[model samples]
Structure formats: C-alpha cells, structure tokens
Target: MRQTELSITVPATANLGAGLPGATLSRRLGMVTVRDSRPINPNTWTVTVTSTPFITGAGSATQTIPTSRVSYWSGPAVRHTGGGNLAPGQPTSAQAQTLTVPRIAFRKTSGNANNRVSWEPTLVIAIPSGAVTGLYRGTVTHSVS
Candidate 1:
C-alpha cells in the first residue's frame, strides 16, 4: 500500500503594505496547497491556521496588533484535483474569522489517494488608532492533519 500522508504549503511571507492608524489593510497571502495521499476508502483531512501578534517595536501593547485584530478568509479554491469535497473555512469577508485561535482553513472529506487542494487566503488587519508607526511583522502558521 502507498504511504498515507497529508501536507500543507504556505507562502513564506505576506506583505500587507502600509496602513494609516485606524485603517484596515487587506491582502492575499498567496497560494496554500494541501496534498493528501492516503489510500484509505474514506480519507479525510483538515487544515488549521493561526497567527501571532504583529509587533513593530518591543512588542508592547502600543506597538502590537493582537491576533484578535487579524482576520483570515480562505476564499474559494483556485485549483483542485481528485475526487473530494473541498471546502473553504471562510468563503467570504462576512464569514472571516479572527486569528486569536486555531481555525480551520480548509477541509477535505470523502477523498482518496493523490488528492490536492489549493487556495489563496486573504488577511485583514485592523490598525488601532493608538498603534505605533513602524513595520509590523507576524507569523501565520498553517497545519494539516
């Protein structure tokens, strides 16, 4: 039997550009690919995502954008293959979820071997009026299981 496996790929970096205080910035995080190669009859997999606070200075409250201020939307899949029901966790902006906790980004159900799903997720950041001015950096993590 083939080796059962599940994996995910995410962009190394996503630059949402500059935004003024109290402004909302949104940008696409590039392509996220999930591959499932399980030979089981009823294979299933899920992709979860999370993020850290974005800090520009010493990570103080004034210089930090909490994970709760970061929102994610796993828009529709750009490409996919094999037979499976692939669904996006947040298909629209109204359904976007905060990054305060691990949220399902994508899921595949009733799929077999050699299946793949790809999508471009968007990130929206809400800059607080009291936020400091500088380049804020944060990490967004994606996992599959």
Candidate 2:
C-alpha cells in the first residue's frame, strides 16, 4: 500500500441562521490534520449534517425570522490555490473542521489531497419558538469516506 501522508487545514468556519429564508451568517470551522490515505486527484463529494443546536444568541429570546440559511461555499475558502477559489470542491475529504455542538448522523462534502486538511462545519443552528436559549450548545459527529 502506497502511503503518502498529507495535511488538511481550514481557516474560516461558518455557522449561520436563516432569519427568513435569504439572510445568511457564515461561521468558520477551523483547520484539520488527517493521518490517513491521500487521494491522487480531486473528486466529487456532498456534505450533510444533522439538525442540532450550534451557536448561542439569547436565552429564550424571541427574535425575527432569519433571512438567509447556512451554507458552505468552497469558493473563497481561505486557501491560495495559485489559480483562484477552490470552492464547493471537497469538504468531506478535508483535513480539519472545528466543531462546537454535538450532532448525530451528520455528514458533509469536501475534498482530500492527503486526508489531513481541516474543515469548516457549516451548521445551520435554528432558533425555534419556546426554545431554551442562552448559549444553547452541543457537538456534531462527523464521518468521511
């Protein structure tokens, strides 16, 4: 088995809230390092996450309905590819992605050069009615292929 170890690192992380349906808030995840097999070329991937409470806003604070929703735009992903943005490319194969909340069966799509890159878990933390606010936090469990 050919072993070529590479490192993955994400700079900015994003966690957003859709007040209505158009508004968006981009939060940075972080860097990552995987000690596993690396892919020879870039591949296609899809990222999916479980519905969980992420960031905190207010305690039982009823606010307006958000506009935009949470999204992961690979482009302008905080990396210098020498060419341009390498967005929506491959996060599932990222090296590192900082997480705060606790989730289950959550998956995201990313790229992999050495499987040691950090990733940004763009979680969509929704604020529901009668929800116990005040820094409602948890964790998100990730899985890659």
**Stretches of candidate 2 exceeding 4 Å from the true structure:** 1-26, 32-48, 51-76, 80-121
Give the number of the best model, judged by lDDT: 1
All models: lDDT? 0.91, 0.34
Candidate 2, lDDT over the whole model: 0.34
Q: How close is candidate 2 to the true structure, as a TM-score?
A: 0.36
Clashing pairs in 1: none
Q: Candidate 1: what lDDT? A: 0.91
Q: Write the per-residue lDDT of candidate 1 for residues 49-130, one digit (tens) a residue.
A: 9999999978888899999999999999899988878889999889999999999999886757688899999999999999
Query: Number of clashing residue pairs in every model?
Result: 0, 60
Q: Write the per-residue lDDT of candidate 2 for residues 1-145, one digit (tens) a residue.
A: 7766433333333333234323333444543322334454553222333323344565223432221222232222332322212333334434222233222222223444433233444443334444333433444334333
True-vs-predicted CA distance for residue 88, candidate 1, Å: 0.7
TM-score of each: 0.95, 0.36
